[model samples]
Target: MTDPATLSAAEAARRIRDGRLSATALTEALLDRIATREPGIRAFVHLDPALALRQAEAVDRAAKAGRVGPLAGLAFGVKDVLDTADQPSQYGSPIWAGHRPRTDAACVALARRAGAVILGKTVTTEFATRHPGPTANPHNPGHTPGGSSSGSAAGAAAGFFHAGFGTQTAGSIIRPAAYCGAVGFKPSFGTLHRAGMKVMSESLDTIGIITRSVGDAAFAMAGLTGGDYGDPEARPGRAPRLGLCWGPTAEQAAPETREAIERVAAAAARAGAEIVPIEMPEPVAAGLAAHALVMNGESADALAWELDHAPALLSPGLRERMEWGRDQPRAAKEAGRAAFATARAAVASVMADVDAILTPSAPGEAPEGLGWTGDPAFNSLWTLLHLPCVTVPVGTGARGLPLGAQIVTAFGRDGEALAWAEWVRQAAVA
Candidate 1:
């Protein structure tokens, strides 16, 4: 029989609400898939089948009692960086080996409020930084599944979970989602609550989700995004116009990757949306460098506790980066901020003609080896601008693997970006 876990959360919820399928059966199917794939995928850092089933059962019971919401009977996988009261929120570092939280992160609670079953936590790079996790791409285990939110995308792509939660400081969400061939959504900065989420770069970290379909990603955003927990900057609005640019950054993508995006752009243009390719004003490389600068400057504060004594427990990649950040002069941090401001201003000029911007989700498809997580060169600029971004799978790559495109919105216009993402995905499939 086909795996029930392969169905999107929105689809599964309908089946359950109509009594066409039991939530328990669906949860069992996912748990079984995870049982078979978890060993090889390592997508999950924690797994508790009993708890998941119990939650599913309760959801089914609630639905039977005429209680159901947008996510009734749906299951979700959260990243390790997000605190779960039931699961240990180890920051993927040995120093916090047994750490647990007494309260759920705001994002986790939001999922629960929507009646989602918390399947488990997925792997994240050490402290959601440069260190790669053990999770492999389901498409080709020989290759690396992108870093940080590695397991979340792998689980969704491998049919273990229909949808999973992830976060992006730089490319923790979109890069891995691209590499894994899944739909990744990073709403404009603070669109989703970040309370209880482990801090990487306070200014850059944003909550995101991964799913098999843009429709499902929208279903998730309908619930995952809201006003704010505490961040006053989280207010959101609508977006109408869209900015298009296929310049230096497009040139930067691997040849095959660029073609995939081109195919999608053509299809999008035919679908009645305006398509305008403009000059890529800001230096793409400079945005990446500034991201590194700020990331390094603030990382010391986030890792202060662990770095104080168990410095050796951190991964070499993270250790080296921390040390690099430690030595960075205050001037570099200021310069990075100044550079980000200039880029934001340039982005504003681009946004004037469009409601949002369209960009390639990744430089290329998932790379061949797992030695290093693929580059996040294409994603960091938007992250630095603190805008919302959603990755919609538009086509297969040169080798038949999935390829995705990024829908970037003006800062605080997350809803508009998501609407465009929905239209693009629908158009792509059509």
Candidate 2:
């Protein structure tokens, strides 16, 4: 039998429902795996084995009673930025260390209610900003796992959890999942409620899921939002028309990323997908700059209390950025907002002829060293435009690090986005 710890969430759910595997057994396997692997990976900041087991036990009993929720038997890691009533949510800062919320974040509460066991709080960059945590890539400990969803992605890849809750202001979810060789699903803006989360950039922040497979991500989302994300394995009657968009970040892509895109395009073409080269509209391309301005400005405001009261506890890099954001001209911030509005309106035209856009999930592979997470140039445009984006591991880079291909669809088209991403995943493997 396959190791329960290594099973995808969809597979685990099926096994549990069929009485072939108990939720307790699966939870124990994951706990054992964490015990053996967590020291080197450092993917989690808080873990309560007893609590996890209790949840699993309850799930097992519910399954026996034929009253299981949609996510029964699945275990997930919550990003530290999200509130978890049972666990400390320090937001990766010493200032809020030992802080526990009175209620779970909406996403956490929904997941738990849907029968998913909370594994623990994963590390995040300070306030989900630039400063990274201690998490090292599971594939290469010497390399950095991308952030600020660092531990969520790493934990998903390391088998510590079947899925992870991640948020992306820029590329927090997709980039980290790419680096860690997992599937990242950043749905359309507001797809998942964000109440109780540490809000950074209100306009750009999006809650997402990180899973080992595209199907697992889709399954989790369907359970969480009660939306029809569709079956990942479902095939469309006609071949998909994919836009091969390099966007404005083409210049920033590493050779490996460029190669991965071309390789995936060719494979997709062979699989009957129409790969049409399309240029992003100027306004949408301009979102790269707008994203930076809006993110920094809003983040500064969001952390006003920390900046004023406990500035000493914040990281130097984050502190500097926050201070810069706090001092930005009001007009400059408004212009940035205008740019996003224009871009959001223009993106529809860009995708009018294509079912989805195929692009790079990150610059290349996970960069060496943990100090700087890789650039989010390839991902920010989509985030700013409020499009649905998903990344699947396509291949590996020169250093044996993983590389991923991003699939993006128009706003509110999450079901299609996930379906197309799964298609890309299948083509890459075929």
Candidate 3:
């Protein structure tokens, strides 16, 4: 029998609901796994064994009473930036250290309502920006696990949780997941509630999920959508018409990464999907540039209080970013906004002919250091376009590290993105 802690959320939930497995037993297994792995991975920042046990007991009670929810008896990790009433919501900066929110974030509340236990708070980068955390990759402890959602990705990969919360202003979710060998799904902008989440860039800070498989991701997305502050975009029904995209950034991808995309696309094509070659449009190319400005300016504004009051606590990289945002010319900011609108329209025009596009999840496998998270170059454009994307692991790289390929659907077509991703994953295995 598979270890209960190692089971995917979908499988674990089923067994718990059938009374084949008790929530208490499952939770104990997961907690034990975390205890064993947390020392080296440093994936969790705040873990309350008692709180998790209590939550598990509640789920067991509900299950025995025949009142199980979709995620009953499963555990999900929360990024430190997301508020947790019982845990400190320290946004990965010394300034907010030990700060606890009076209420859970909207997403957390929904997860609890669906019967999943909030396992712990995962480590995040400083303000979910350039600053790296102490988390090490679960695959290779010497290398980085990527950021700023490093811990959530590593935690999911290490089986500390079935699925975990992540956020991507750039490649925070995908890059980390790719590096850690997990499925990372970034829903269409505003698809998940962000009310109690730490804000970086309003335009690009999308809530996301990290899971072991696309099916688990789907289960989570199904339950997380339709919250008070969520974007209830209708998912289209049909086999996806996918376009193969390439650009200047594509050239920067490691040979292994490029090969992985080609392999996955070929497999999907052989499986009856239409694959068209598409170039990065000019406006979309320009929007990628604007992404940096929008993120920098907004991050500066969002963390202005800390910049002003706690200069000593701010990281050098973050301090520089804030200062640059503070000094940006009005024209630059406006140009970024204009560029975004144009690129958004251009991408939509092209999407009319296709359900989604295939792209690289990262530059390559996780880089060989813990000092920095790998580049977000491949993920920026789609994020800027507000498209929903899912990164599925297609194969391993030269070093045995996982390589992922992205499936990106038009804005508001999250279901298409996820469905196509699951298809591609299945095809790869076949």
Candidate 4:
């Protein structure tokens, strides 16, 4: 039999349901893999092997009784920023260290009820802000795994879990998944409920999923929201009309990113996709700048208590940004919100001719150091506009690190986004 630890969530669930694999056996294989690789990866901040086994055992027993949820036998990691009753919901900060919630975050609760085993809580950046955590890229330990969804991406890539819950306030979900050579699906804003999450920027904080394959992301989303995100193997009836967009951040893209985008475009074209070279509308392009102002302003308010009472506990950089946010003129915040509103209203027309926009997922491959989490220039605009986005690893860069292509669709088109992402992935690999 294939190594159970490496199977995708969809495949694992199918195998378990088919009576070919037991949840307990799959969980044990993953635990064994983690025991050997976790020390160096540091992908998880909290892992209780016994608890994981207990969940898996219960799943196995439930299977015998013909009671199975859609996600049975699938093991997943929860980002630390999301509350988990069994594990500490430390938002990657010293101030909230060992913080536990009385109930699971909505996403976690839904996953658990759907029969997915909670493997552990993955590390997150402090307050899911600029400050990164200890997680290193699973591909190269010297490089970063990206943040603030660092551990979720690294864990999914390292086979520690089949899927992971990630949140994006900016590019947390897609950027990390790109850097770690995994698939990231940042659904339309509010597609997944955010109750019990440490939301830094309410406008931009979107819950997402990261997995080894686009199909796995679809599977996880179906279980989490009970939505028909479609099967990974199901291809669209016709080749999609994909807009090949360089976006406003094209100048900032490394050679690897540029090359990767062009390569994927060429491959997708050959596979019958209509690759249109489209320019972003002015209002939408302006949202890149607006994203920062809105994030900073909202984050300042979100962390006000922390800044007021335990200011010393906050990171120097975060404190400085929050202070700046606190002092910003009300007009500044309003202008930022206005920019987003304009962009969101204008984006529909921009996407009217294309099924989705094809862009770079990051500036380049994972950088050589873990200090910085690369740039979010390519991703922030879409996030600010409330678009659905997905990233799939296309190839490697000069540094042997992975590069990814992002597929973005209009708001409320998450299903289309996931389907198109799978198409792009197949085209790139074919």
Candidate-wise lDDT, in order:
0.79, 0.92, 0.86, 0.92
lDDT of 3 by residue, 154-229 (tens): 9999989888999999999988998898999998888787989999887789999998887788877776653221
TM-scores, all models, native as reference: 0.90, 0.98, 0.95, 0.98
The local distance difference test score of model 3 is: 0.86
Candidate with better lDDT, 1 vs 2: 2
Off by over 4 Å in 4: none
Which numbered prediction scores highest in lDDT against the true structure? 2
lDDT of 4 by residue, 1-118 (tens): 6899988788899999988999999999999999998999899999999999999999999999999899998999999999999889889999998888999999999998999999
Per-residue accuracy of model 1 over 1-430 as CA lDDT, tens digit each: 6567778766787888788888899989888887888888889989899999999989888888988766776888999999999988997877888898999999899988888889998998888887777898998888888977998999888877767888888888998898888888787777777899888787788888898876677677775553321211122333234466553455579887777767767777777666777665755446556888898778876887777788889887788888888788988888887887777777676776776677888888788777788888788877887778888777777666667888887787766676787776666667
Clashes of each: 7, 0, 0, 0
Better of 3 and 4 by TM-score: 4
Higher-scoring candidate on lDDT, 2 or 3:
2
Off by over 4 Å in 3: 226-240
Residue-by-residue lDDT tens digits, candidate 2, 1-430: 7899888778789889899999999999999999999999999999999999999999999998998888998999999999999999999999998998999999999999999999999999999988889999999999999999999999999889988999999999999999999999999999889999999998899999999888888899989989998888887777799999898889989999999999999999999999999887788767677787789999999999999999999988888999999999989998999999999888788788899999999989999999999899888999989999999999899999999999999999999999999998899889
**Which 10 residues in a row give candidate 3 its minimum summed lDDT?**
227-236
